[model samples]
Target chain A: MSGPAATEAAPAVERWTPLSRISVVAAVAIIAALAFGPLVLNPDWVDKLTTLFIYVILAVMWNALAGYGGLVSIGQPAFFGLGAYAAVRLADAGVNVYLSLVAAALLVGLAARPISAFMLRLKAGEFAIGMWVVAELAHLLVNLDGLVQGETGTSLIAMTAYGAESRRAAVYWLALAAMAVLVGVVFVLLRSRTGAAIQAIRDDEDAAAAVGVRVLATKRLIFILAAAGTAMAGALWLATAISFQPKTYFGVQWTAYMIFMVLVGGLGTFEGPLLGAVIFFTIEAWFGGSGVWYLVGLGATALLFSLFLPRGIWGAVESRFPLRLLPVGYRLRGAPKSL
Target chain B: MTSNDDGAILAASGIHKRFDALVVLDGVDFAMRADEAIGVVGPNGAGKTTFLSVLVGAHQPSSGRVRFRGDDVTRLPAAERCRLGLARTHQVPRAFGGMTVFENIFVAAANGGGFSRGEAYDRCIDAISLCSMMSVANRRAETLGLLDRKRLELARALATNPVVLLLDEIGGGLSDGEAGELVETIGELRRRRIAIVWIEHIVHILLQVAERLICMDAGKVIADGSPTAVMSDRAVIDAYFGEGAA
Candidate 1:
């Protein structure tokens, strides 16, 4: 009889997940600011940091799509532009400025349903290039006059409607709250069955399908979810800037900057984007004047990350500690083996 | 004499398949009775695997209808076929490399076998037990050896609780002793009343479990009879044994 199984020791995984540690700190820090930052930091600096939080949200959205879904899209500006437009239009029509951003975000993400039907027909590389073309078309149409004042753009005129500085500060807080919620939603989804299926698809599609996963539906859902969340980020961005131009609203550099952060920090791991975002802001502060060189260096770094460390920095870190901080799966360690 | 009328669980009549210009299955007809065990054998490029593909809904035949329990299901997707109690393994094992062995079995049990999570977890243990692989359940599939891999492939398929199982070369790369053990396990499956169409080159193992044997050549059934009679038939000998003469 195989007496008590000769137990080979189980592989050691993570003691604590990077996902939990990072997100806890991030959320607590943001909430702490809402509770106490007004007492310590200068209001001007707080306002600037709030704007940066919007960028963090954008990077998180792109990371969810590319790092997790294996979709490298260079044209997220289409949703961002539409979202801002939706926010401004609804506000012009008497909706609350804050409500407009939320509505706009949801609408832009939902509007992509018909578009995804067309986009899904394209293969991997073609689909990416197609998004670029679509973004350009969307930008052109919005600038064609009679829609949100076309080329002249639209302005909220905060001074005329209410006290300008206070409204601006309130909007900053609103933007901060939006980023926190979006990040939480994405992280939760990533740790669910849907997240597991997407991760499996990222590794290999045919294998995922053989296990009874619905590949297309999962991808489409995430794509739309990311798009909508990104749209909200765009609305808040415009709200903070207090000005919207077709060129500025539809800038490709927004996607470029977010991709750089995602690649530098990590793709699949949660903390990578935040880490990358901080690194980016630091570099921009140091090398403020070397404009094109900043672009060149950023591009080069992304290339290196893609070619050499395809898993990203956090991926490298996690390999040493295989235990997932976000332990979404309920594991069943079968009965103790009898060797 | 080979007709089955006890509510043919899966029936394929006048099925033909072609890959581009190369004709593969030429008007082949096959059927699985409620609990019959049949083995298919053929030379290379003889459409044996192709027949399984058509039956499992992995590929569409150029022509001919497929019926499951008397209802036409010729154009269903592979996963849907699995949901309807049809399961198959590849000629080469197709285990998901990134997944754990237990996770793989869990998928087969839940998604294909129509079991709940608790039930899937239960069946996964049973599947691992059947393959004698409880020791390596937590290991990644890419780390498994060839013999264990062959065992895993059948165990996963069996985990699907398939009423009509299509196995392609299940015994191809196994050791003789392991193959003997597998033949006994498959014999156990036969006794449990699972219809099987096992395609393999290992004649003796198939002979031990299959009540009927089919020889396919040029996408058509060349010989169909009792295992000994089919093996002894001159055409079967000429096509299979003739290769050794060359």
Candidate 2:
């Protein structure tokens, strides 16, 4: 039989808050260096660091949809490819490059409205797989037309129009800026009342809905927001490479990389995905073209970590020593008030 | 609390519900004054749970009108009903298993009652203290045992700040002392004048609390009156207490 309910003593009931002590300071310092590392590095390494920054933004978007919304999507490449295609098309049509990039991201968000209607019909595993199929089909459909030059793909002449050095530097800074904005947006969202609703629904949707949460609409909004961010990351990737192919832009490898980063870093918390992305990028840069063995190594590492530290590295660290790197959501116990 | 009985806080007329032609509530009609602590006593399959579900918008009556505070709310969704101050517990406490004990209550206060974070926290803490589940507030609902889970369930409903609270067997799984403590807490609620409709199999407990008692069977109320009179009514004695319940 269940005992009398456990009444908390005031101290134990006090809400947990993370302190930005040495650990957080160290992590942030490291991240800052990583983002700007391209500026201080040899010219050869600039493109790679910029790529890592894009990965940071992409991981955050994926984590937001899966970790926070409980909608684990394996088809984020759909948005990524859409963003690239939009940018390439706009640059082709003689539009200003920057405006095209922004429009490209927005278009992905808008398009997600209808896509979600169909995808949301499936739940959990089915939904995740459905998104993957959507991405693959999108890639196939887009490749069939000469719009993006089919399988041969098309060279993005904008980087040439802008020249090599400035283009490289611009892409690097833009990726950094995008990651920062995505992180900031996530922090703001986590702090809002809506964030609490999202977290609640993620934990127990039926209970959340019973308590007046609009589970479907809220999730749809997150879907669009996260997709838009991912699309922007994809667009930036294409610009950095100055090219796009159906296979490359919509590659399932990007999905694999995103999932690995999130799972390794910490799926739910802010800064975890960023940290994970940095770690994965480091691993990739060091061992990238050493063949498929590199990927196998990363997967093996993830399997061990997932088995041992299911919450991911940052999740474990956060529990032992709280660091309020991203302070969102309310802490209720310190003060007493009349309702 | 101010009495607002004339406002007809809850009304049900011809509330018919069926489960594939096995009629549950056969034209059940009932009404409650504001802050009235009414009791619903019934044997198994009597539609008492179904009746409460209709009141709380969890189920729709086949042909009936349900008005709350003189406003028609038969078609409103469950969340809207919760926002409008109608809340209920499950017969078997369906606490959110994945959420923390505190979070379960917080959702109801914030989403169900439209309370601000500070306001919702206060109400949630208050409800937790009343139900006495605060110690496990940080613990996942999945980890809670039967009695504590029931407390969590009560905490959730109470956090909604309902004007008309519908409880479905909160005392069912509890021990005598636990039930007695809950009764005392509920008695305090009664003094504060919150309208309550408690459905239970425990006759004496509701008799000790509710001013009026109802007995339902086959989806219809067979008896409704003061506790003592209804407890002794021929049909109630036969169906509920039988000859040995005297």
Candidate 3:
């Protein structure tokens, strides 16, 4: 089982320790298996998982924005709707659906700069409501023109070119890829200087400013990042549905679901949202056929989780175990252990 | 802006600060030499801390000029002033409570002082070691006791590699032994030629490190001279120690 004899001059300290390497490798292997799932799973299951992936992205983005950045926004659906509309319109114009998805997300990211300039001026609760107002405004404007077909809605006709099986497979892979890339970006950023500065601002704005952290600028960056990732998830959702309505895309329910997922998972930790998304998706898949009871159950579950486990499932687990699958912050190591 | 001009690292002239008709600082003029230690003594609400805040860019003076090495920095923000090597510790000991002790100093050295990554790490280690905080360097700042928190406040400011350090009542709540330890740290800092302006109620501790001492009351300087003379001045005795105290 041993690959080689022990080297006498191994490093006393390592930035990428063997334990961390194992975590990274295990994550990559799991992702690869998920990417190949459409090959064996039924079309309906692949479709269900595609929806789960989009929620995963939403939950993760919301967690970072609120949990780490101290910006609890309720208006993320604004960009989500914009991205969905962009994707549908581009596909209608005969562009590649995949390319249109990316372009729509980028367009949303660009719009975030100006949006943040206005929204970030508001403090915590005001900021949350401000985002909702922005989403409502976007909904009204999208209905103003025939470009989105207003209330009549529209479909992604470009998808008709592919067979049902191939279409399902492509959509699943696209969702998986988008989730991996966005989560990976967040992971990398949380390990960098920008992440440190953002956490500093989260802890104390005045102290962070005194230490030369550009407070407003860092908030703006996080706002834009959350917007971009949320928009990309929106675009993927449109691809999954192959159809969209303004009311459907711009619903406040998206924000509610995001909050539920992250709240039940944990706030600041990386594993919280991922674990939350899986649990929520599993519960929905099992009991969703009951319609209104399903939603009621979800609401009750969220309330119970909030009251009993304020830190969420992952948060509780982390407190007990101190497990860090993605260790971004530093932990001083003891002297090297003897074999 | 020359660092050697007038041999002063910081100069504030005709500084005035008011909050809705309440004058916190009244036409205060102060200056610090490149290698000097000055002590400020006054009763509570005498605007001692307010003066330090104005000097460090935490407050905007109503009408005045603040010169750092002969360059006006009155309009600059707190972060900019910190980056330019003017740093201060808060009276309440504000440490970055969520971060480790080492991370707190690292952030100050890297961001406030503009040191490179390697140099900032070195500077942080040096600062904590100087403050005798190496044992708690990995601990979260919020977990520290009063003495360690005070040490962290000082160490965090020191990590900024300041040209002129403004200290506000860091010795107020310390035991005599703890205060003595802090005095030793400040003495070591003075040996490095860093200008120090310390505001303290502990007159004896102030007398030990400050070559020149100034007394203020009702937002104006009442006495300015050598430490011994200022301590014994009739006006200082009346304003700070009360007329009855010998």
Q: What is the TM-score of chain A alone in each candidate?
A: 0.87, 0.88, 0.91
| Candidate 1 lDDT tens digits, A1-339 | 222343233322122456767757766776766645445667786676776778788889999887777767778888888888888788878887778879999899888888788876676798788888878888998888574577788775432365656665667677778877887888888755577667656655654555555678878988898889889888888787767787787888887888888988878777778778777877876775798988888889888998888657766775566545444333334433211
Best by lDDT: 3
| TM-score of each prediction | 0.85, 0.86, 0.90
Binned by DockQ into CAPRI classes (incorrect, acceptable, medium, high), candidate 3 is acceptable
TM-score of each candidate's B chain against the true B chain: 0.94, 0.93, 0.94
Residue B92 miss distance in model 3 (angstroms): 2.1
**Could you report the Cα RMSD, in angstroms, for every candidate shown?**
4.3, 5.1, 4.9
lDDT of 1 by residue, B1-246 (tens): 234524789888888898899989898877767767898998988899998889887789899888887778898777777777888888877776655676667667766677875676667777777788767776767788887778778888877788888889989877899899998888888887888999989988898889989999889998988898898889888887785558
Best by DockQ: 3
For model 1 chain A, give the 10-residue run with minimal summed lDDT: A6-15
Q: What is the lDDT of residue B142 in candidate 3?
A: 75
- Candidate 2 achieves a global lDDT of 0.79
Candidate of highest TM-score: 3
Model 2: CA > 4 A from native? A1-18, A21-38, A290-308, A320-339, B1-6, B16-27, B60-63, B96-99, B237-246
Interface RMSD of each: 5.0, 6.1, 5.6
Error of 3 at B164 (Å): 2.2
Worst 10 residues of 3 chain A by lDDT: A3-12
